[model samples]
Target chain A: MNFFLGIKIFFRSLFLQSVWNYERMQNVGFVFSLIPFINHLYKDKTVRAQKIKTHFGFFNTHPYLANLLLGIVMRLEEKCLKNEVSQEEVLRTKTMLAGPIAAIGDRFIWSTWRVVCSFIGVAYYLCSGKEGVWYQANIFVGILLFLLIYNLLGHLPLRILSIYWGYKYTNNVVDKISKFALQSYIVKIRNVGIIILLFASFIYSISLISDLKIVLLFWLNILLSLLLSKKIAEVGIFYILFLLNIIILTVTNL
Target chain B: MKLSLWFLFISTIAGLFHLDVMVFGQFMFSRPIVVAPIIGILSGLPEVGLIVGIITELLYVSIIPVGIKIPPDSTTVAVLTVVCSERLIDIPVALFFAIIFGFLYKYIDIAQRSFNSLLLGWVDTAKAELVEQRVNLLIIYALFITYLKTVLFYLIVLPILSFFIKQVFCCWIKNLWVHMDLYNLIYILPAIGIGIGLAHFVEE
Candidate 1:
């Protein structure tokens, strides 16, 4: 029954953003995902309703990492039902875990992992070039490979393990997670991977530019844009570069 | 460049899934790199889709939603760029309009989320009444609102933008394309994208 409940919650956790609101942020979805476990633990309808109401309070975190919280909460709730733990304790645990977990998830998954995967994807597509009988096929493969690698390798394992370990070690799960050392390794690997991909893409871009003057201009433009990106919003820089291109083209034609 | 109903329908569904499923499943399909190519392939212009996707993806690499602050909606920007570019306007022009609309849609998303808070009052009342089913109903309502927003955005914007490009700006764009070496322009956009991507690492 515990195994079934964990799997059910995992599936429901996917809908973590369905009813996202400013007041409570992922509260409804979080509660909804844990409904099965809540029902299983609290046999009485009123108790079940009470437990659900308790979860309806403000709860926001990265959606992916929320599964880990859900697993840990389920274990705590089970203990609470057995009079081994208090309701306040479970609520406090949820509140404590939300922020740190969100920070780790936002940094590692959103920033580092995603950036690495995208750089690699772009590099793959660029290197493939727009030629040959299988050019279109190559592009499709490159895009799919990025999606597969990101979802399969990066996201799925983290989510599954978080859920599993959250259940296995309900007490001090956060400390265990913090001391895991796997995340640091992943970040290190991602940093190295991004650097390699950037160099590859730069070399490829250079090869494509035959004219030395144009190549120098390209590097100059890249440097200027990089400096501008710090001060200006991305969209702003995009518009400026775009207008510059139009103006340059118009002048060259004139 | 006639628009196909099938392409429009598929793109809308893809847009819906990109936001909806991506949020739920944590799949990166919502990213421009993935969404653009899928839309491009469906529209029978995979190359344009791939190019637009890469540029948009790189440009918006740093725009992750860290906490409460919402990033400008890159997925919408990408889908609209590819779909609109299929008609006739240059990819950059399509991208420009898409970026504009993307910001517009971002505001709309914020408004929608704010509006959703009103629904929570109903949820509270339902909880008081002990009608837990109402909460589920409200969730479905919220999801529907999200779906409707995407569908309506595409249904209204793509055709109008395509028409405007075809009617008013056609000759101007054509003239620009004729006079300009587009190859050089293409190289410039990606270079900026690469620079932005690299900038994130350098900062860290």
Candidate 2:
């Protein structure tokens, strides 16, 4: 039946996953977590360990680089499995590529694209005439599109990096990229630059709030921040904002 | 095949109230794009239920469990929440369910820690045995405790919760959530965008 074929596809995907699937069963756990029923089949330790590695692999890279690395690794996994490459080579290749891909994916996909999409989604939600399933679906699709396209493209360079330069070459490529990204993002912006950017953006966002009372409530937050600077937890900002709104509602006739 | 229904029913009931289930705690099993829909059919309201489940899946896509920390278990939350809303009420309600599910996830973490403690105890017992047998017992006991506690919790609690939702409550508890608002929901989109942007900005 079709059900059997589906199972076959899933297994093939798993196999494809294994080639670049360095994290092993952890990815399986992540993939299955999306589904509602089959989380049980992959319950054993071997599976869990594998998936955990894949899931936590992000810590190794810049967000964008991590996604790209994963994409390439995924492609590599598929092609290598189909070609019946040796297990030892696959292991060696993975050990080599994992670090570099993680770096790239983190920088490009996780860092950059995620921020861009989130802002777009937020803007759409904030504006009128954009409040329905269609809008929601589009936002979701936007996120998916970024993940898919960037990841797929990221793999292409990785293939060349791993194939031509091999492990050392790949490491060199990662090192350069990391050095370049860090210099540009952190050094160029610096602390003052980031603070200015945050202030500007914060002001722009506050304009969208429209409700004067709400604006006033948030304005108080600046003073609250200074007053509580000694012991204020970042999370307390959210709580204070929430409390402010409740207090405002109770006091105002509107 | 019949057992699938048992899993479906037990998972749904256990998920319905956010109660911790035994044995079959792996609700993520039902989350596949294909499999979840099929399972939804068995439970009734197949179409909406499946779609809702998928939406829930997408919302929590990036959330992957690692180490001892368990992210919110959306499997039970998504399935039972969708089923309850469609049969008894509506779809927007599922969002509220997602939030509550996020909180319940903390307890699941506690359960995992408890499970790990039992594993440590087994390791101690294994230490006293022969070196060869000790290794085997350690692996066996470790896996056994992991699987057993989850399964046992689901089997005992799920049926009881199901009866309560169906017979006693008549889904009344859901009414308490009706006043919840969907205002500023769209803000989450831009928040994600900002997060993504910052992430990218930082990386490069």
Candidate 3:
């Protein structure tokens, strides 16, 4: 019976809310959070549905950002749904919070932290070799750490902030945090230099042993990019590369 | 189940890096990623899986389900690529084969829409039946059709292509192959241009 209920929730979350309302992605995150509690609520369908809907409100998160959004929304949704808040009030709370959460969550957790963790993982793999259980554990642990801290910071603020200043206040808090992070000195000039260095090195490395006249490839790339920049959105460069690849292979007998 | 297993694996890896770009790690296991990878992993090499993933990812990058415009069927590309790559009896054949495979994937999506129409018809009948069992049956049928669409795509198309490529195609005048280094260069130039374009022209 419990299993059936769980499946029903999964199906509804996945199909009904996701498809009909066209917000299925968010519902999937909500269902993921509710999965643990689901097994415990075997007999009570009413409470199960209520609890699921309550959490389902946190749904708008990107898949990778799911944990953070899930963590925060889970806490915040519970409070808002329980209050005598109007529907507009509820929605206003969600909209205001979602963008701010998305910004901080994207920058710190998704962009910066993920880069750091992946770099650490890559370094570990390079240094220690990719074979051992330890390496595997390190990779797994790195990912888990990302999920943990991201979700914790993402979720924890809602509880404290919502309690103190209502839901809208939490949005400003998230904004301030994001603004501070973005404006940090490290994000200024040095980051620009690093980006330039990475690109130059990347292109130089690619120029090695390529038969298709490096200059031609270079020109085509520039032209295509110029087109892309001008918003002439179409598949140009890829097909050009394809045609050029065929011509080069034919001529060079490669 | 076999098809689904394939889809999940392929999509997971493909979506892993790229989806990180936009959603910044959100919505990885959604429809396109889920479907595209399923096709590549099941029948072709990981390279094919990766290629198909990249192609579909780029194709769909600007398309968001913000309003109408249901995005093109990305799963079809994976499924067709795997099928063509296996059947065509060539590893580094023209990228044209990929375009062909991509086109075929779109057609299969048309078939899916047809199937959806039939399923909707059944949903109406079930509603009319006033029997709760019909609702359950309809749900089961929908699930079955989703699985069926993915499996039949590989099982049917791959074997036929494999036979045709192996028997008929000849290795004549094969030369214009782009080296991997050049391929990397081709990919990178745009990033540099974009960087330059944004920095030089566009005001932040």
Candidate 4:
């Protein structure tokens, strides 16, 4: 029964953002996903309704990392039902865990893993070149590779492991997560992946700029880009480079 | 370079489903990298879509939607760029317009989120009335509103924009392409990508 509940919750958790709103922000979806477990646990309709209503409070987190919170909350709620813990304790657990997990999740998944995968995807797409069926085939392969690697390696495993660890460790879940040092590992892996991908991109960029003057202009743009403070949006830098490209091409006729 | 209603219809629907990623699957089909190429293929120009998608992806690599901060809607920008410019405008020019549209659409996304709060009020009423099923209905309503926003934006915006590109920018792009070394233009894109990649390290 516990295994079945875990399976159900895991599936439901994937839809955690379905009914997102500014006010409560995933509160509805959170409640929705927990409904089956709540139903199974509570015998009385009133108590069940009360349990469900309690979850209607503001709840937001990184959607993938949310499964961990869900599992921990489930354990806390079970204790509450058994009178081993108070209702306030359960609510407090939810509030406390949400923020930290969101921070980690956003950093690891959104910033690191996503950027790494995209760098790989862009590298593949660029190296495939500009024309013919071969290029088209490579584009499709690159997209498929991105989705597969990201979902299989990063998303699905993290979600399942989060749920498992959250339930098994309960209140000590943070310690368990820290002990594993998942964040550091992710950062390390991402750093290596990005370095390799960036090297490939660098070589590709060099090969594309065959003319000497254009190479000088390219290096100038790189230096100029490096000088621009990080406060400026990367998109803005791209536009500047694009405009420079047009001007250089027009003037040099290379 | 005439607009194909068939492509427009398909793109609108795909765009609507893609917006559902925000609320539903989060499967990332809604991402510019994915959606742009799909649009390209549907419009029978997968190569254009793929190239534009790569540039857009690299350009926006660091801009993830963390917490409540909504980034520019690059997916829409990408779709519009690929679909509207098919044979009319140069890819680079189309990309420029798409970036402009992307910034504009960010405000639209914010407005849609604000509008969603009103629907949340309705969900609250349903909960208070003890009509449990109505809560589900409200969730569906929210999803529908999201779908409507994407479809309406695409349907209303794309055709007119395509027309404008055809009339105003086509000749200029054609002239630029004729005068410039195509290799230089092509090389510029990956150069931007490399710069952005290097910048990513700096930001970190």
lDDT of 2 at B93: 41
Q: Would you list the clashing residue pairs of candidate 1?
A: none
Docking quality (DockQ) for each candidate = 0.56, 0.07, 0.15, 0.51
When sorted by TM-score, best at the front, the candidate numbers are 1, 4, 3, 2
Q: How accurate is candidate 2 locally (lDDT)?
A: 0.38
Please give, for residues A17-71, the per-residue lDDT of candidate 2 as tens digits: 1111222212321222212112222445444334323332212222123233333
Model 2: how far is B190 from its true place, Å? 7.9
Q: Between candidates 3 and 4, name the one with more favorable lDDT.
A: 4
Fnat of candidates, each listed: 0.48, 0.01, 0.02, 0.42
C-alpha root-mean-square deviation, each candidate: 2.6, 12.4, 9.5, 2.8
Clashing pairs in 4: A18-B23
Model 3, span A11-62: residue lDDT tens: 3323321211233224433453344434353345555444444444434532
- The prediction achieving the highest DockQ against the true structure is 1
lDDT of 3 at B14: 40
Candidate 4 lDDT by residue in tens digits, A1-254: 28888888788777688776677888877887787788888877667667777887889999998988888888888888899999999999998999988988888888788777777777777655434322444667878877877788888888878888887788887777788788677768667766766666555555555566655665666666656526567778778877877777777775
Residues B1-204 of candidate 4: C-alpha lDDT, one tens digit per residue: 334566458656666755546767676677668877878887788777887787777777777887788888778777888877665226777777778878877888777667656665554544433534555675677677777777777777787777777777765566666567644564457556556666775566
In model 2, the Cα lDDT at residue B123 comes to: 25
**Residue B121: error of model 4 in Å?**
3.5
Q: Estimate each model's TM-score.
A: 0.92, 0.40, 0.50, 0.91
Candidate 2 Cα misplacement greater than 4 A, ranges: A1-112, A128-171, A176-211, A214-240, B1-204
Model 1 misplaced regions, further than 4 Å: A130-137, A211-214, A252-254, B1-11, B21-23, B87-89, B127-131
